[model samples]
Target chain A: MFSGAQVSLYPMTDDFVGVILKAITALEPYRPDFRIETDDVSTLLVGPPDQLFPAMRDLFVTAAGSGVHCVLAATVSRGCPGEPDDPICTPINDVHYGQPLEERIAAAIQQVEAAPKTGQIVAAQFSLYPLGSGHHMDEIYGCIEFLKNSGVFDRSKNFCTKLRGDAGAVFATLSEAFLRFGAPQGHVALDLKVSANSPTAV
Target chain B: MFSGAQVSLYPMTDDFVGVILKAITALEPYRPDFRIETDDVSTLLVGPPDQLFPAMRDLFVTAAGSGVHCVLAATVSRGCPGEPDDPICTPINDVHYGQPLEERIAAAIQQVEAAPKTGQIVAAQFSLYPLGSGHHMDEIYGCIEFLKNSGVFDRSKNFCTKLRGDAGAVFATLSEAFLRFGAPQGHVALDLKVSANSPTAV
Candidate 1:
């Protein structure tokens, strides 16, 4: 059965939701074995992951159709807001693509260590997506729970993630975290530079 | 004068490139300042930053216009391929957007940091966007040079980059790096999930 998912599109912060809506509408012609819906913020299409791929291709091809050029982001899922009927309401670990928050937190720490500048640790800020404002601490604590529950690593000491390594390592670490969280597949905008104390390698 | 920056989109894999291309094509109407040039493995779009933003918007709209959504990686830049008469033949500290190899490497780091597994440390497996195809080391080195020269942060020992506090600081540091070496501003797509990791104070 196709999992019901809420797919939202962030188009550089604009009321440009119509494009995706149009694509979703176009899917009707394909006779997909799934139910699809569209709104201003996202297009919720329901179907097996396999079926979704082809329908998505058609939508991408026509809407983002060739000869046009632009950047984009999208998501797919099932379930509705209100109450907690959807499996997504539960912690990510409980979901199909979910990874324990502890795993994510540990990954963040390891990411810091893996940075190209592993020895010289500096200012680093790690965050979980969709935690929303006024709730970062609560969200972080939840992550700790996942960590403790999962016998992957021990959170014996006060574990705070600090970015280490060179620019390369720092950037690499960030990517891993996003993937682990099952970040909505989208483009990545990155900017990184080497430290001044480093050699004149450039 | 308009900055003729070259923007190249490098998807994690060749398969992903097709989707990216569709997103770009959909953006064509909006991105008047730039022109798209397609190569075998990548697509190059040259234009100014002002126009690039909207173009990027369209691209993301188109991608989100589809169903696959995520911000795996994205970048912006201020330079383009050098002319034969160009004095430096691409300045050692120069950063441009047309290059994909450098951005891909940077993105690999980002994925590592964001993923919840692998300890968030980008293993060699995820070190390069197009894994196993070694090329563009010089460009990567160029980015390192640009980061060091650009006075975006304080020079701390190790791989530390001193910036303002929290989100602003990270944003600023990344902005400088992208403006100098990133491709035209655009939305990137990747799979991301927002989860609460911390436990609430019961």
Candidate 2:
């Protein structure tokens, strides 16, 4: 299934231009593993689903490392029916794709537990969409349940769920939510916003 | 039906605090029409759906008038089954609800045509979720058709659709897209991000 994200980073400083440019270089190592394109609005990273979070994590960690308030906005999707599949994002199979809801939740939790620690702490909120499906609510509810047990779950807001923890685990939780709950090979997306070193009291 | 939005404004300037505080004053007039609250992360606005866009438009216009880069992030929703209905946001009846998709698209276009031009130019991108319905994509595709004719339609990006025009038409387009698509009584959501005077090349 095809999967990708359009990501933009904002640094809250007069030196924003330098911070943003320097941070994007973190995606360089992942270039061979994915197809990355940058435009005026955002950077599009397309390729395998598993490599996606790590790439984003590095980009964010690098930017946040500047010790200035920073925010990253990302729109992530997988298996969108309307979008054509790309060979670079293919050949990968999810063993738990067709598992029962309970089983999938269990598998997702295990994935998060094994995620490598990136050390940087961050807060994130995301609204997931499992589109064109009759049982979308069930999937969303199940995702909520999984998130609560993911150790990074913070709280549920009006339009999205919040999470906070090490960047590694936080990104892992997001990855599982986007992949596990929605119908595999169907249209699904996540409207993700993340902040690191935010000045506001949280 | 219940409707509300969680909105966060980001002013891309060193004096962000001043810009945000000054822009918030624009919401005062709409306070009588909606229940409003501000926290560290965002401002919560709940009220009649029709008035939502106007309130947001004024806020954006005020901030953009400062001639600094600004971005507004809003998560808007209506008729969510999981959320309790608030009386403050009640009594809204969309006349076009339950109509054929084509008719709804035409109605939405009409609404945009009558929108008041705010003179502030803006660009926005939003993803609408009409959850748990088998025809969700049909509604989404229908919305796409409406946006193309909305007078604010920009180009469609990878994860969300973009719009650019006077703040009035852009915001009106967003309101119509939310109210006109999806099941009126079922859960629906929009992840909206709008930019005004963005210093970066758009």
Clashes, model 1: 100
Q: What is the TM-score of chain A in candidate 2?
A: 0.96
Error of 1 at A159 (Å): 41
Residue-by-residue lDDT tens digits, candidate 1, B1-202: 2232223332222234466657667665744444555422123344543344334434543443334432322223332211112222223223344556556446433532342211111100001011011222343344445444433323321111222122222232343334433233221111121111101101
With a 3 Å backbone cut-off (N, CA, C), the pairs that clash in candidate 2 are: none
Over A1-202, each residue of candidate 1 has an lDDT whose tens digit, in order, gives 1133333322221223454456456577644455555432234555443344334434544444322222332333312111124322233222233545665666555644543432322122232222112333344455444434332222222112223233334434434443344222221111211111211111
- Tens-digit lDDT string for candidate 2 (B1-202): 6788888787766777788889999998988889887655667898987778788889988988988877788888888777787778864454547888998998888889998878888888888888778888788899999999998888887768989889989999998998889987778888888887766656
Error of 1 at B63 (Å): 1.3
* CA error at residue A183 for candidate 2, angstroms: 1.2
Local distance difference test values of all predictions, in order: 0.32, 0.84
Indicate the docking level reached by candidate 2. Answer: medium
Clashes of each: 100, 0
